[model samples]
Target: MNDEEARTRLLDAAEALFYAEGIQAVGMDRIRTESGIPLKRLYRLYPAKEALVTAYLERRDRRWMASLSAATRGQADPVGAVFEWLAEWFSEPDFRGCAFLNAYGELGAGPAGVLDVVRRHKAELRALLAGIAGPGREGLAEQLLLLVEGATVVAALEPGPGAAVRAREAAYVLVRADGTG
Candidate 1:
């Protein structure tokens, strides 16, 4: 395959392995094997494992946000739509909490860009929530962000989408109380 194709394959393998397992647990050799890319080529494509991890997270962040935006776009109740989207995501068979959070937990203190990626993802999410919450409701947006993150963690720990459901209920109350719902 060409460079682009090889890069995509490497990233695909990296994302799957890293997300299914954890960043530190999956090595470059395994990624090479999974992607069917030669070790030399894999190293050439991503000079280091940290580079690969950062690339994986960057791509995932883009796709994740895009999916969320698509799901909530044009909805009459954008805030409710956000929770509804989370519920669906939580119910996915391969659901495993937030990938960015998982990466942060695994490699936050490292010299890698994992922390940067995680922070950017979160800030973008909060911005989305803020837009939905509208101007002058920054506190509400922050509250909603906490609920979303909390629900994601709780969902990861528990079975089913109970956390998202409960979070959605709480969000409704908050929004109503804020007179925005």
Candidate 2:
């Protein structure tokens, strides 16, 4: 295959394996076997497993944010739209918690780059919430973020869904209290 196809295949494999199983648990050879790309080509594309992991996280961040963006585009209540997106994500069949959070839990203290990516993703999420919240509601944005993160953890741990619903209810209360609801 061509370089672009090979790179896509490699990253697809990495995203699947790394997200399903912890990043540290999966090795380069396994990625190669999963991707069906030759070892030499894999090395040429990623250069190192760290690079691959970084790329996977970066790609996931972009895609995740984009999905939320598209789902919430043009909504009057951006905060509610965000919770809607979260609820949608929480209901997915193979939903395995937030990828960035999972990565941090597994490798937060392992690599600087990994932690950087997680932090950046979260910061972006906060910024998005802040923008949606509008002026004079910075505190509301922070509380909403906490609710979002907490809902993610709770939904991941609980046997059933509706964490997002409950969090959204709390967010609504915050928004109304802030005069933005």
The most accurate candidate by TM-score is 1
Best by lDDT: 1
Clash pairs, candidate 2, are none
Ten consecutive residues with minimal summed lDDT in candidate 1? 106-115
- Give one digit per residue, the lDDT tens place, for model 1 in 5-115: 999999999998999899889989999999999999998989988889889989998999999988888999888788889888899888888999998888766844777
- Tens-place lDDT per residue, model 2, 1-181, is 8999998999999999987888889999999999999999999988988788888999999999888877767897777788878888888777778889998888766778878888999999898888778777889889988998999998787624599889989998888888875
What TM-score would every model get versus the actual structure? 0.97, 0.94
Candidate 1, backbone clash total = 0
> How far does residue 76 in candidate 2 sit from its true spot (Å)?
2.3
Score each candidate by Cα lDDT.
Answer: 0.90, 0.86
Worst 10 residues of 2 by lDDT: 155-164
Model 1 stretches astray by more than 4 angstroms: none
